[model samples]
Target: MIYLDNAATTRTAPEVVEAMLPYFTEQYGNPSAIYSLGSAGKKAINEARRTIAAAIGAKPEEIYFTAGGTEADNWALKAAAECCAGKGRHIITTKIEHHAVLHACGYLEKNGYEVTYLDVDRDGILDPESLKEAIRPDTVLISVMFANNEIGTIQPIREIGAIARERGILFHTDAVQAFGQVPIDVEEMHIDMLSASAHKLNGPKGTGMLYIRSGLKIRSFIHGGAQEKGVRAGTENVPGIVGFAAAVRRALSRMEEKAGRERELRDYLIRRIEGEIPYCRLNGHREKRLPGNVNISFRFIEGESLLIMLDMRGVCASSGSACTSGSLDPSHVLLAIGLEHEEAHGSLRMTLSEENTQEELDEVVGHLAEIVQRLRDMSPLYEDFMKSRRDRT
Candidate 1:
């Protein structure tokens, strides 16, 4: 099968797996234990922390390991709110954030905190001026994503961080999709809190990290043993952490080469799809986009139906629809970008990986063009468009 959904998750790299295998078997000891084997495990954890910290220009002590991006996001928001409880009760974020941040904000709102969800422009970008306008005296935190997951639009995080720093509000960014794909320096960005997931960068699942700037006082989100300097409480998954560090190292070391290759293939796919397909529109920014993301909306067909068709042809892709409470609803991210309900329903997200080749891109474009045409032929919207065209003729 041709896998094209790297944004959701990536396949673990062989080197990462090799680096983790020894820990799962030979180094099978709790990091908190004091015996020789356990000491080795503890040392491994510390090294992983240092590696990950260096990747983002943070101190090893400031990096707190968690279950994944969701947990990190939760910890960042909850801890920030609790730390500044005496100072304020308001937060700011964008509408295009992952559900992790949005739901956390929702929970905060229910508990008497105020939150401002800023709108995005047509290109799915949050205006820095709009963010400045949203800040009130009570606003204590600002959370925005480093890059959008579905549409691949990179936000003006450095500008937003500067704004937040000048205002004395804490800045947090969900960098789950941007960590391995782009260059990040927390010190230069002035980010107080940052979230990253291992699986998104070809490392193991169930492992991630939250970077909290040192000297910042934040309450603990989890209470148990003093695993992560009392900031997070849990037994360390030694294997996953090792794999995460290895993956981060490899991805960063080869980022320039991988990025160039992925961009070439991505541009090839986009050009072919737009030139060969009918009644389709590309979503997200044309140039300032991720190296391996292509989101498109076919005018007449539902995204789910097209996805199934592509799957049948051995191609994997995703739609922006959600199965919430057993009812299918259009994706909030799609709607937030100004797509109508029906238009949003027709959205397809195709994320590429560096491993994909030009041959794979060719096959995917060919299959997707066929599937979209087949689905549009049965669409009522297509009939309407045809009728309108005939009337104009």
Candidate 2:
């Protein structure tokens, strides 16, 4: 199959698997134990922490392990809100955020805190001026995603961070989609907290990290053990952690080359789709988007029907975030970027990887064009519109 859904998750790298094997069997000891094997486990875990921390320009002590990006997002948003209650009960985030942040904010609203959902422009970019205007005396935290999962729009995080820093409000970014694929420096960007998942970068699932800047106190998310410096309580997934570090190191080593290749392919697919397909628009900022993302809204067809057709043709793709695949609702990201309900319902997201080639994209595009035409041919909307055009002419 030609896999084009890297944004949903990646196939774990063989190198990462090789690096994790020893930890699973030979070094399988609890880091909290007092034995030599336990000490070794602790050392490995610490090394993984340092590796991830250094990647984001954070200190080792500031890195906390979580189950995945969702947990990290919850910890950052909810814990920060509770911890900074004295400072304020108001939080600011964009309408295009992953549902993890949006749902957490909903919970906070029910609990008496205020959350301002900011809007993005037509290209799915959050304006810093809107953020500034939304801030109030009661605002204590600002959470914006580093990159949109659906549209792949990279936000102006540095500008937003600077604004939050000037106002003394904590800034957090959900970097799950941007962590290994893009360059990010927690210090340089003035980000107080950041969330990333290992699986997004070819590492093992069930392993992720939250970089909370030093001296930033948030409440413990999981309550049982004293692991993670008493902030996150659970036995560390030593093997997965090791694999995560290995993946991060491997990706950082060749990020520039990999990104260039993926960017080339991304643009090629975008150009092919827009040039060849009728009544379809590319989603997000064309030049300011992710290096390996292609989101398009095809008119006169349903996204689900197109996805099924693509799947039958041996190409794996998604219409929007995988998390909401079963919801039957139009994508919030697309809607937030000003797409109408029908447009949002007919979107397709095709994310790539360095492993993909131009040949694969060519096949996907060819298959996609035929599939779209087939589906649209069966669509009453397409027939009606064509009839209207003929009548007018």
Candidate 3:
């Protein structure tokens, strides 16, 4: 299959698997134990933490491991809320955030916290000025995504973080989609909290990390064993952590090279699809988008129908966020960008990876053009368009 949904998750690298195998078999020991084997496991986990911390320009002790991005997001938001409970009960975020953040915010609202959901522009970019205006005296935290998973639009994170810093409000970013694909320096960005998942970057699933600035005084979201420096508690997934670190190292080391190739391939696919297929419009920012993402909306055809056709042709893509793919509702991201419900239903997101080649992209473009045309031909919307054109003539 020609996999094109890297944004959902990536294939674990062979090197990462190799690095993790020993931890699973020979070094299988509880990191919390005081024995020799436990020391070995603890050493591996510490090294992995250091590696990930260095990659993102964070201190090792500031990193807390978790089950995945969802948990990390929950921890960051809830912890921030608890830390400033006496100070404020207001939070700020965009309308297009992943469900993890959105749902958490919803829960906070029900619990007496006031939330301000900022709207995005036509290109799916949140306005920094809007964020500034939305800040109230009770605003305690601001959470924005580093990059949109649906359309791949990079946000003005540095500016947003700077604003939050100037105001003494904590800044949190959901960097799950941008962690390995783009450069992230927590110190430079002034980010107080950040979340990332291993699986999105070709590491093992069920592994993620949250970066909390030192001395933030946030409450623990999990309680039990004193793992993750007492911030998160659970049995450590030593093998998964090992694999995550290996993947982070490889991704950072080869980021520039892989990013260049991804940009080329993504551009080629977008150009081919828009040029060859009629009534197709590209989504997201043209210049400030992700190197590997190409989201498009084809008029007169549904995204689910197109996805099934592409799957039959051995091409894998997605219509919306992986977490909400089963839901029939139009994507919140698309609606935030001003797409009508019907138009949003016609959207398809294609995310590339380093493993894809020009030949594979070309094949995908050809198959997509054929499938879209076939489906549109059978659509009543297309038939009505033809009738209108005949009347105009």
Candidate 4:
């Protein structure tokens, strides 16, 4: 199969698996325990923390392990809101954020905290000026994503962070899609909190981290024992954490080469699809997007139908986020980027990995063109729209 859904999740690397095996059986003690086996577990967790910290220019003490990006996001949004309730109960975020942030904000709103959802430009980029204008005397935090998962448009996080810093408001970024694939420095970006997931970078599932800058204090997320510096409590997933660190090290080591290759292939696919298919438009900024992301909307075809057709042809892709796959509604991200409901419903997202090849992508593009054409032919809406255009001309 031609797998092109890396944004949903990646195949765990063999090296990461190798590094995790010993922890599963041999060193299975809890890090909170004081015995020798537990000591080994604690050591491994610390080493993983340090490795992950260095990769993102954070100190080891600032890294707090979590179940995954969703948990990290939940913790960041909720805890920050609660932590600064006295300062203000208002939070700011973009409309194109992953549901993790959006839903968390929804919860906050139901519980007395007010949230401002900023709109993105047509290319799916949030404006720093908009954020500045949205900030009020009661605004306590601004949580914007580093890169949009559906459109892959990279946000101007540094500029947004600067705005927040100048206002004494905390800044948080959900970097689930951009962490391992793109370069990031929390300190340089003035980010107070950043979230990342290991599974997105060829590491084990159920493992992620939240970076909290030194001197920043958020309330506890999970409560039980004194794990994760007493903030996130629970027995650590030693193996998953170890594997996460291994994957981070490997991904960063070859990030430049992998990104370059993926960008070439992504550009080629975009050109091919747009050239071969009529009434299809590419989504997101052409140049300021993720290196391996290709999102396009076919004018008359439904995204679900196209996804099924592509899957039958041995192509693994997505219409939107895996988290919201089965929903009948159009993608919020697409709609937030100014697409009409029908246009949003017809989008396709193909996120690649370094393992994909030019030949494979070319073949996928051919299949896609044929499939889209066939679907459009079956669409009465498309035929009527074309006839109307001809009549107007």
Off by over 4 Å in 1: 321-327
lDDT of each: 0.89, 0.94, 0.93, 0.94
- For candidate 4, list the clashing residue pairs, or say none: none
- Residue-wise lDDT of candidate 1 within 313-357, one digit each (tens)? 888878741212133687677788898888878888888887888
Estimate, for each residue in 15-108, the C-alpha lDDT of model 3 and write its tens digit: 9999999888899989899998888999999999999999889999989888999999998998799779899999999999999999999999
Q: How many backbone clashes does candidate 1 have?
A: 0
Positional deviation of 195 in candidate 1, in angstroms? 0.1
Ranking by lDDT: 2, 4, 3, 1
What ranking of all candidate models by TM-score puts the best one first? 2, 3, 4, 1
Model 2 is weakest, by summed lDDT over 10 consecutive residues, at 212-221
Point out where model 3 deviates above 4 Å.
none
**lDDT, candidate 2, 290-370, per-residue tens:** 899999999988999999988988999999898999989999999888999999999999999999999999999899899
- Model 4: lDDT of residue 319: 92
RMSD of 3: 0.8
**Pairs clashing within candidate 3:** none
* Per-model TM-score on C-alpha atoms: 0.98, 0.99, 0.99, 0.98
